[model samples]
Target: MNRDKDIYVLLTDTGTVLTKIIRTFTKDPLNHASIAFDEDLNEVYSFGRKNPSNPFFAGFVRENVRGEFFEESMCALYRCKVSQSAYSGIRAQIQHFEQYSDLYKYNLAGMLGVVLNIEWEREYAYFCSQFVATIFKRSGVSLVDKSPLLVTPGDFQTTPHLELIYHGKLHDYTGCEVTAAAAGGSFRTA
Candidate 1:
């Protein structure tokens, strides 16, 4: 696959926001910058400046900016952070790459594949959840079912930091029964 076609998936609680920011950085030629809401009016954020000595900043800019004029030697340093994050043994990979130039090519090919797969999975899950919710809505059924999909104690792997109580059942079983019947499913009752 072409390097430009490769995707990077960031998996975290704020994945959506992170993905948007990354896209903005990659899609633009100018140094993308934004002011923090909490910061004073005098201060401004400046990203993407070419600096050879500072490996960290150089790497960060190269990853964010595509088709920009970056030195060939700095490409290894630019990919170092990604290599370290995706694999446990970066030192070994670097050493191997040094001994065999062909290894670097293989390493990049594998890493790009992993990144694209992760992005696709995240996108698929998000769309699937949306589709499920839409089906429930169209069937006149609430998506938030009350009969906990999870049980207590076994589900309580962590201590209760917060708690909420519903005055009534979140889902209507009667509506579900009608929908299920139409959809060719039988709900067993005791």
Candidate 2:
């Protein structure tokens, strides 16, 4: 699909959103980790690096709302388009069905299944927001009006006016920073 259209597809997929969050760390020189939390501030999944190539690979360390945590391997790769470099192309999408969908049925096991399946494109920020919104919606938390969330780049500068959606409502959870990196992937709880 075209890059723009490919992003639209990602915005619509529940799994792709979660994957984007996980994949954000892949762009960094450090193995940065991400922590996914529930409404009650409980840990969900910890996606981080398993080994160190040089202590710079980004790692994922996430725990469930129930306080469960684990490690997994993650990588970032891109596809090519006719007019774009393969490194900057849009490829297949990803989803976290087992993480969000199965959360109601299973515990970390279900989350792990979903964590094992995060994916996204190389340089799309707007689509990344949609992905984040999808995860919040699927996780069963409603968004409050005017909620604030943070999306940071490699330099740690926050994107202005990024919309925050939660459980179908708009909420302000601004302290959270979503970083898009390049390298290994994982989740972690803080």
The digit string of per-residue lDDT tens for model 2 on 151-190 reads 2121111222122122110011111223222121222221
The local distance difference test score of each candidate is 0.22, 0.24
**In candidate 1, what are the lDDT values of residues 37-80, reduced to their tens digit?**
11111211112222533322311111211112221111000000
Candidate 2 is scored at a TM of 0.20
RMSD (Å) per prediction: 23.7, 17.5
Question: Highest lDDT, which number?
Answer: 2
**Estimated TM-score per prediction?**
0.17, 0.20
The 10 consecutive residues of candidate 2 with the worst lDDT sum are 5-14
| Model 2: residues with Cα > 4 Å off, grouped in runs | 1-31, 49-157, 161-190
Query: Candidate 1 — worst ten consecutive residues by lDDT sum?
Result: 71-80
